[model samples]
Target: MDMKFKRNFCIVAHIDHGKSTLSDRLIQKSNIIDERKMKNQILDNMDIERERGITIKSQAVTIPYHAKDGNDYELNFVDTPGHVDFSYEVSRAIASCEGALLLIDASQGVESQTVSNMYMALEQDLTIVPVINKIDLPSADIPAVREQITNELGLDDSQTQLVSAKTGEGVDGLLEAVVNYFPAPQGDVDAPAQALIFDCHYDPYRGVVVHVRVKNGRIKTGGIIRMMSSGIDYKVEQIGIFKIDYEPTGCLEAGDVGYIIAGIKTVSDVRVGDTITNADNPAAEPLAGFKEVKPVVYSSIYPMDSNDYEELKSSLEKLKLNDASLVYEKDNSIALGNGFRCGFLGLLHLEIIQERLERDYDQAIIFTAPSVRYRVHLTDGSETFVDNPAEYPQGRIQSAEEPYIKASIITPATYLGSLMELCKMKRGEQTNMTYLDEKRVELTYEMPLAEVLFDFYDKLKSFSRGYASFDYEVIGYRPTQLVKVDILLNSKPVDALSFLSFKDNATDRARKVCERLKDEISRQQFKVAIQGAIGGQIIARETVSAVRKDVLAKCYGGDITRKRKLLEKQKEGKKRMKMFGDVELPQSAFLAVLKDNEAD
Candidate 1:
């Protein structure tokens, strides 16, 4: 029996492109996982992913198959992050496998990101196994899709496979393709053990649960290991290999992937792309191609109450245990009091965490507008983080810079003109374009990451009528005119509403932001003034609707009905009002300015 070698693969698709449903069907048909309990994106492993139907992180599982040749084979599969913010982790996932299962919705066909992901797979020298998923849908066009994969992704007829990840159709053929087409690992078992830690998460008791791909080595429970990159050494407390059901695999050798539970317990202890090796004779260097993710979005997260400061800190620490990409530091927020300024890969990733904190932790969070990190050039010749516009010495700042990204999109040909208008509006510099098929086109542009984060997807959906998908990767940072936009409430600065913006858009952006705040904030028991000011000049102003019925006019001698209403009103007043001199400022006044909409 020639050792049957099957290529490990992962399904990569854009959000709403049906990656999870397809994976669910694949696992279900193998009888490796029960469908009744099978939730969408079971591999997501996070409550957030289940609710959103998006895979924010990558996951791995194994399903055995009986090949057409009547041979036994194991298909080790991984599911990866589709969003660019998680690209750092996604790159590692791509490296762990020999091929990818690129799922495309039959009706939507090839999306903007589908081509990008396929190209990344090619860069890794991984074989492309294109999948036309959701074929069972009423809208699915099977023939046109096969052409797009071959033309856009450069896949041959042999590489294209269509399947409905929903109905479990064509999945067996997809399994067969993986075994027949993809090449197995070419390695010597006797060579030095060198595995790569593609990704890891903090697992309280176990510390860091390092996800490793054995490039070369043998590992087992109780074996001592060292993170060759971090110089951190620990004895393997447990070795668990992934199946539909995880169990003690006893050991993992060269070309296999599994989790290593070492005594080392910290996120900082295991980094993506780091090499793991035997402790006694460690590999001297980490693998090349490890790129540290640069956070492009910044915002302040504060608790509604000043007393919740400690609670917020503990909450962030917990979030950081799993998300090492997040960076934060203690800071002051005038509106919400003490808080921390946090860095995120992008805005979507930032909003997701804030929502998770509120939903999962049941804590109300006061969030500031997202701002991209700015590079400032001082007259004295120095570079500094101009995060807080308040800290910026306007006259002294000679020049400023912000990060930029290379964005690409795939959509129906009908959306080409509409999306092009949007791209131009976002300062998107046209790079190139390719037609995926007669009905679909792939558009490429270079855009400022800041502009992309400020509701690029929302705009894309509206213009394209929800037919297009968006993706972007940071190309590099460049010098640009950046300014800080500040908000004032009754002439007093509200720190949480302040953010960074392009100088050209400042006045108009300020006006729009002020308008949004005015709309979201219901009028308090007192009139509140909202102003958008640049230095001494006020560009826009809006006032909260007056509280006409707040004054007690019909009460005499504390009449029973009036007295009851008065008592309840008094409690409510105390809950929301803060007094300074003769005037009372409603807590609602502070909250009214924290609107979700970004100003134009």
Candidate 2:
């Protein structure tokens, strides 16, 4: 393929703004897949993505389009995730492309994430094509969305493409516009081979399937390739492009996006942002790959069965190959046994990983309560960071700080007051408020990441009646009154159930955990005491009463002294049982503490 006729771009949009749908339409129009075999969200191969109606990973495809200018063009585009949690994926997609289709819902207009994604594309200096999607909807306001594109996004309205991805209306024109509007990918085909690894997945039989965007030179079948970061060499077994399914091309030249199979067995040998270059004629410097992804939320994952620890480890390694943002290290808990302390971009990211492990990897896992990293200053004038409750410093005497984020939320003007109140309740400080238009408003707040780690997003949606959109960026840490709240069952602290909470809400949080545990734990032969405590002070307590055995039932006609003696013996036996008996904490009990009490 000629480099001048090749166009590499990606679709960037907010969640539910029709990126995947638009990709499906392009694929259908390109005639890549047979009509009978085509499906909705064809680019999203993961079952979780289909079930959740969201794209978790970025997918690339090659579209062969014959433009109106009497020229054949090869359009390669990546369909990226819109959720704030997967912004890293979007960044990688943007890096691999020279242009971006910024899709906006016609009815929703400009949203928080929409603006965020546009800025991301702008940062990469990509040619952005503003796209107003869902124009076929009865509620679609094309003119209003056009105004947003001009005023809010500072994009020319005349350049915006209005289309309905669902109805496939004006899609042909959109494809033509992509060819004419976006510039051709620029790279030296004769230079040393340097392909940026945007993604990869493990195939049991073929080994690691590395997704690459060739920047310079060409990669041929059965050629030696080396990972710039790891300095490991492998033989490229095959090269192919994605047309929903892998289509072998034998060779991939510069300015192309495709996959490479090198029979690489180790998961860690290939990294998502590493550069792949020809070993025989290597590039002097690796391509500027990608920024390191930092995880804002942390949790401990343990196998339900202790023996599945190795399985869990292998699953995580394989999962990490696909999800580079997920970071984990060996972690263990006294109550939960062996586990891994994993870091995620957000709560949704955490949930997705948990689900993928269970569904794709067939590993049953337990996740502890999610937490944000906290900076602790000890009395000895030393500093340390804590993400896991068990690792919280016991002798902290000086001060502590928690990570904070600048949150941007867009919603209808009518819900501004309620959303503001919600943020206030979360200990958020109003940073800025702007009226995007007469009907919609954008609110910015500075709040602790720990506050949003739980049900903040859920509450925001509920408070706005699902009209709100949110995006956030970490804004460093602020001094806070932090306390480690521990949940104790029968006077024994469960390390997995411990969590850090703000001092003001620690009592309420502790009380909720105790109440939740009370409902989850079954009645035992002896009284089970569930207590939430900080240091020596007990903040909240719940007691699960013992299941009584009626000793007096057998003495209905007995004398009062005999009945009294039987009752006294029963009381004595109960005391002994309380002293020796153990309170078994069910899996549900651990999950119960993880749930937000107020979210109900």
Candidate 3:
């Protein structure tokens, strides 16, 4: 293979600016992933990501691309998560690449976080390739967007590539940019075997499939490669690069992005950013890099069917194969019995993970509202975890400090007022504001991570009429007045669904959550009681009345299937309820919206 063809680059963009969709188009054009199997955003590789149209999980694909000069070279495509919760992961992702293809939606050019991410890439000294995507949109102003990228991102004219992911327009120019500009891998080929584990996953049969970029020398299959940081060694079983799926091949040489299979059954064996060296003669030092991922949100995840506890454990173990930052612990409660406490990078990260757990594992899970990590100080000078505010007793909290982020919002001037108002309501203080161009304002605010992760985002967008986009990075922890709001169904408290909010916002938030729960339960075939309270004060309550039509619609004698289905539906309804003799109230229920605007 020629030394010049390989360009390791990541695709970065603001949330909903078409990063994942653009990635799908790139995969289709490169023919790396089989078109039939290549679902939109194939690199997301997670069902939650697919449903949300966001890249919660990052993945890589190596494909061949052609230049305008009629030459071909392999381009390793690393798709990155767009949210700030996964920013640390994003940094590690870009470190493995030489450059990035920055996708900017033409109508919404150079968002706040877009600049921040591109700046991170700049700090890493990676080449910048600006791509103005969604140019096919009627509102697209390609020339203005290009100018914004040039001025704000500090990239050259040659660096900007325009493409419409939906229409497959100008994608060839993107490929050309990859080959012409992004430099090949730079490393010492003669040095003793050394590789950086960028990402990895555990396969029950094949062991751990670690995604590594060879920094020096060569690594062959069947050889013993020891992770220098942990001093753990594994026997290599397979070495390859993913071309749609994993394609096993020869030894991985320096500068090549590839995968290695080690006889390790767990994801914990191959940590990200670990240095890999041959067991015979290893490197003196480990790959001393990457900041640790600290989760800002904690949630309880338990099987809706309590019998699926073992299956839930297996499912989470499998999920952790590639997602190591996700922290889970078995939690037993007097109310919910047994469940797992899961930590996530942020609120979106928690939602995405929970969504994938249900979809991929085919198990229903009761996921609690996300809570921020809290710092508790005891009189005895011994500290303990109190992620859930409900765990803290009244007057017991000497001082409570919650995590906050410096959030940046980029939207049209029309949305400026609404966004600022939204920020203020969330206890955010404006830091700076800049105009990237006419009508486009970049407003920065210092707000609690907890504040933004709540319905603050939804309200912001709704107020701005869905034109506002937000990104937040953790600034530091700050002391504040917070309270735990618990939701009780009937007289019993639902331990898993409680939330913490500022004293001011607790009542309204509890009211809204309980009402939403009521509306959701009203559609179920059985009765449910929904209530929200703070301390002993009941703020809101609603009931999902029992289905009057639940009686047999038509009894067909001797029709075993219909009888069985009727019994199944009744049994299911029975299971969904907390039987109060005759009145039943479900812990939760799901309702699908119909065009008729009527309940099912």
Candidate 4:
């Protein structure tokens, strides 16, 4: 394969902007998949991705296309998820390519994710090809969308490709432009092996399979290789490229994308963003562009059944092979039992992982409310990062700093008032606002990461009538009035029900949490008091009344004296039981509190 004839690029857009549909069209144009076997979202291999109509994981494939230029070109397509949570995957995909195809909805114009991804592609120095999708829709305002792309994103209108990914219209021109516009991969084939491992997954029978883009050298089936990051050596078991399925190739050359099976037993052995070089003739230095993924949001994940603890642990380890953004530590809770405190890039990343555990690994799990990492300063003049609210130090906290983010939202002009007001409620400071045109607006704000973690995205959707798009990047930490609120049932505090909250909203949050618990917790023999407190100062409380039975129900036409005797006996029994017996709350009660909407 000639390096000059290879075109490697990724398709990036906001969620539901026709990314997967466009990928299917590309595959069909290349004749990679039979038309009969083809289906919607073929690139999304997971059931959840199809059901949700969103790409969860990034997929890479090699296709052979005969362009209008009368030359055969090998196109390596990396399809990425559109949600903000998977932006890390988008970054990795951009690093592997020399160009990108930026897609935008014809009716919706430029959204927040589209802007975010376009800038990322620019940061990677990739040549971008702007494309307008869903042009066939009745609501598609092609003229307005083209103006948006040109004005807001600063792209030439003539350079944008218009297409309907669902109907396969105007895709031919898009293909020709890809091969003619994007530069081919440039690398020294004679140089020693230096490949960048962008993704990997664990195979139960064959070990860890790594997906890599050969940056500067060649790798063969029998050669010995070492991971530059870990310094672990292994004899390459197999080499292959994806063409609908893995087709073994004898060797992989520079500028080529493929996979390698290296008898790796666990994910810890191989790390994403790590470079691979020949063990015998290693390069002088590893390839550039390696950034470690740091999780921003964290929550406690535990097995619904204690016996599934090991299963959950093993499942997480296996899933971590491909998902390097997940971070976890052993955590124990008096209420939820043994669990792991897991960190994720964002909320969607957190949700996808938990779903995979239950659906793919068959392990029922429980999750606490998600929280952001907090920087804690002690009176002893030291700083620490706290991920769990239950572990926050009391009385020793000199000052608390919460993480902040630069958030961007794109919505219609009519929503400007409601959007800004909502941001203000989240403690957001206005940064800037740009009008894309007469109808669309882009608003930027500086807000706390904790404020956007929960209910913010939901509110954005509601305020804009499901037309707003949001993206956020963590800035630094700022001093804030923060407190750890705990929920108590029957005078005992549940660790899993504890959470960090803003002091101003503490009262409302506490009241809602107690109310949710009151509705979820069963009636006890004695009146159960549900209290929400911060350092022993009760802010909110609720009471669950005892379950009183009809002691005289069995009395049929019996004398009043007999009914009174029975009632007296029942009352005595209840008093004795209430004094000696313990109130045993069910697992659902704890789960209900953890899942409480206002807990955060």
Q: Would you list the C-alpha lDDT of every candidate in the order shown?
A: 0.75, 0.91, 0.76, 0.88
- Candidate 3 structure quality by residue, lDDT tens digits, 308-352: 889999888888766868888888665556788888887667766
lDDT of 1 by residue, 453-554 (tens): 767887888888998888787777798987666787767776667767887778877887777777666666556778887778787898985565544656
**Candidate 2 RMSD to the real structure:** 1.3
Q: How well does model 4 score by local distance difference test? A: 0.88
Report the backbone clash tally of model 3.
Answer: 1
- Which candidate has the highest lDDT of all? 2
Instruction: Show how many residue pairs clash in every candidate, following the order shown.
Output: 2, 0, 1, 0
Comparing 1 and 4 by lDDT, which wins? 4
Q: Show model 3 residue runs off by greater than 4 Å.
A: 2-5, 20-47, 66-72, 377-385, 486-494, 510-585, 589-600
Model 3 residue 92 CA deviation in Å: 2.9
TM-scores for the candidates? 0.86, 0.98, 0.83, 0.95
- Two-way TM-score contest, 1 vs 2, winner: 2
Superposition error at 315 for model 4 (Å):
0.5
Per-residue lDDT for 206-306 in model 4, tens only? 88989999999899999999999778899998998998788899799899998999787867888888899989999888888557788998998989889
Can you give the lDDT of residue 157 in candidate 1? 61
Candidate 2 per-residue lDDT, tens place, 1-600, comes to: 799999999999999999999999999999988999999999899999999999999999998999998899999999999999999999999999999999999988889999999999999899999999999999999989998899999997888998999999989989988998999998899999999999998898998899999999999999999999888999988899998889999999999999999899999898888899999999999999889999998889999899999999999999999999999999998888999999999888988998899999999888888888999999999999988888788765599999999999999999999999999999999989999889999899999988887789998999999999999999898999999998889889998988888999899888888988889999999889999999988999999999999988887695799999988998899999999998888987776667554253
Q: Return the top candidate by TM-score.
A: 2
